[model samples]
Target: MPPRPPVPRLAGDGKGEGTVLQVRRLRGGDAGAYQALRLAGLRLHPDAFGSSWEEEADRPLATTAEALEANYVAGCERDGALIGIAGLRRATSVKTRHRGVIWGIYVDPAARGLGVGERLIAAVIEQARGQVEDLLLTVSAHNATAISLYRRFGFEDYGLDHRSLKIGDGYVDELLMKLDLRPA
Candidate 1:
């Protein structure tokens, strides 16, 4: 098949916003782009992620492919380029099977105000609803933007994890947040 054409960035949404996004499941073939974007996030903002660029940088591409297939990962696209990702990793033990962790929520800097993060998050939430009773994530304590966005989705801060990340000379604290999906 001739390569599929790029989705025009301004063609949808009917509002001339200059960005049209398609948030969907990412498969193994998407590993390269996923890894690139993920590594960029880790390198650009070291405190935001628990993993370091050095740790993931040396892994083979196949490792990334395996991860894409193993987890519930959603990718957002604009103009045919993968721009954002979010993942939902369910608990393996039966006792904790009713919950999942929301991880790796990142949007390219260019896509920040265009709702890319929320789209990735919403897709994860949609996929997670019937599968888990609660969703949890950790955000850097100093990241007000992410905390606010998660709050808008009804996530509540449950606790603080001090010294969550030690990047260079300083420690970064993390805020533990959760969104209950249980019917109350």
Candidate 2:
């Protein structure tokens, strides 16, 4: 198949005022930009992600493309540049199909505080709705900004994952959060 054409940026919700931001499910063709952004996130904020830059920096583009093919990743683009991303993957097992996990959420520091993160999460939630009963995510305990964003979207802290990640002999605890998408 011919390479998937680039998706045009969607008009931003008036919230950004003059900033033109768009969120869409990334395609295999987006692997390069996605990989660059992922590595940047891992390198710039090692504590926020479980994967280290060293572990993924050398991974091939095919691996990233295949991964994107297997999951739902929403990329937030501004002026045609990928600035933020979040992924949602539904459980594949028969018994766990009702669940979806959100991961790899990141926004370029230059784009922070412009609602790019919010748009990314909203895109993930919108995509996951109806397909999964619950949307779950884990965030570093010290990331108050992310916690607040999750809370605003109705995700509540369910428990703590002690020592979830170990980086250079230092352990990081994570807050397990869940958002129930099913109606009561």
Most lDDT-accurate candidate: 2
For candidate 1, give the lDDT of residue 144: 96
lDDT of each: 0.86, 0.89
Model 1, TM vs. native:
0.90
Tens digits of per-residue lDDT, candidate 2, 94-152, equal 99999999999999998887788888988998899889988999999999999988887
Off by over 4 Å in 2: 1-16
Clashing pairs in 1: none
Candidate 1 structure quality by residue, lDDT tens digits, 74-100:
999998999999999999899999999
Local error of candidate 1 at 10, Å?
15
Q: State residue 63's C-alpha deviation in candidate 2, in Å.
A: 1.4
- RMSD in Å for all candidates: 8.2, 7.8
lDDT of model number 2: 0.89
Each candidate structure's TM-score, on Cα atoms with residue i matched to residue i, is 0.90, 0.90
